[model samples]
Structure formats: C-alpha cells, structure tokens
Target: MPNDSPELNHEVTAPRAGTAREWELFVSEDATESPRHVGSVTAPTREAALERAELHVGRDAATLWLCPADEVTRRTAETAALSNR
Candidate 1:
C-alpha cells in the first residue's frame, strides 16, 4: 500500500535563535513503517538542514522530519534507565 499521509511539503525554516543548531533527521521510505533516524545535521536554517540531511542520506527517504536536537530527549548508555535497573 502507498502512503496515505497528509502532505507536509511546505518549505521548512528553522527559527533564528542562535548561530546554528543541530537538527535530528528522520526519513520514511515506507510510510507504513515508522521513519528511521538516519543521522543529525547542524545547519543555520531548516532549508539548510534539509539540504545537509539530503546530501548525507538521500534515496532512502520518501518523507523527512527535522527536529531540533536540543528539544529531543537524549540518554547515554551510562545514564539510560537500563543502568538504574
């Protein structure tokens, strides 16, 4: 089956909060499957972020989502909940 997701094709622009920010990149080749996190990119703008991510991880993506790294929850192997358990 093809992706029935709503189009999110609008141009994406990052907020100019600082010089540059790290954006976490996720790509979906099969929409029925959750998008995979290919890698991260540091860019001054969302357009730049998309460009960088595309350059790095192209062909495998049908849809992409860019999220600020600062906003994403992070847990190192040492500090992860598994460590406490």
Candidate 2:
C-alpha cells in the first residue's frame, strides 16, 4: 500500500466485455469515520470487478458495487421507458 496519498480524481479505463469504461478508487476524508471512497467499477462479476477497480484506484476506501451487465441493461431500459412519459 502507498503511504503517501496522491491528488484525488485519479481514474483508469479498460476493456469490459466489448465496451470500455472508467474505474477508479480513492479515499474520502468526509466519509463518516474511516477512509471510504472506493470508486465505481463495471464487470461481469461484481466482486472480481470491484477488486480490479480497487487495485487501479489504489486506495482502501468504501465501494459502490455494480450490478451485472444484464441487470444494468434491464434497469436502463426500464428507466428510459418510465422517463419517456
């Protein structure tokens, strides 16, 4: 682990399935108590994906787990349909 912290806003982009997206991890002092700023990640398996993302961001902070690709597609469609009204 890196003892010295770098500036925030660090991010990494890589391939996923076919499309590409950005994944980042960082520390947030504002978090309730401990450092918690594990950024977002997208992958087939949430666990593995988050792990990879955490490594990229290089900080031990809270995380927002992402759902599977199919679930995201379904939810997006549902939200689009609802907003079409």
Q: Candidate 2 residues 1-85, lDDT tens each?
A: 6545466444333345465443434454345655443445655455667677657655544434444434333245545776676
1-85 per-residue lDDT for model 1 (tens digits)? 6665567644345654568988999888977878888888889888999899889887877788889888887677766767666
Q: TM-scores for all candidates?
A: 0.61, 0.31
TM-score of 2: 0.31
RMSD of 1: 14.2
| Range of the 10 consecutive residues with the lowest summed lDDT in candidate 2 | 65-74
Of candidate 1, the 10-residue stretch with the lowest lDDT total is 8-17
Give every collision pair in model 2: 36-62, 37-62
lDDT of prediction 1: 0.81
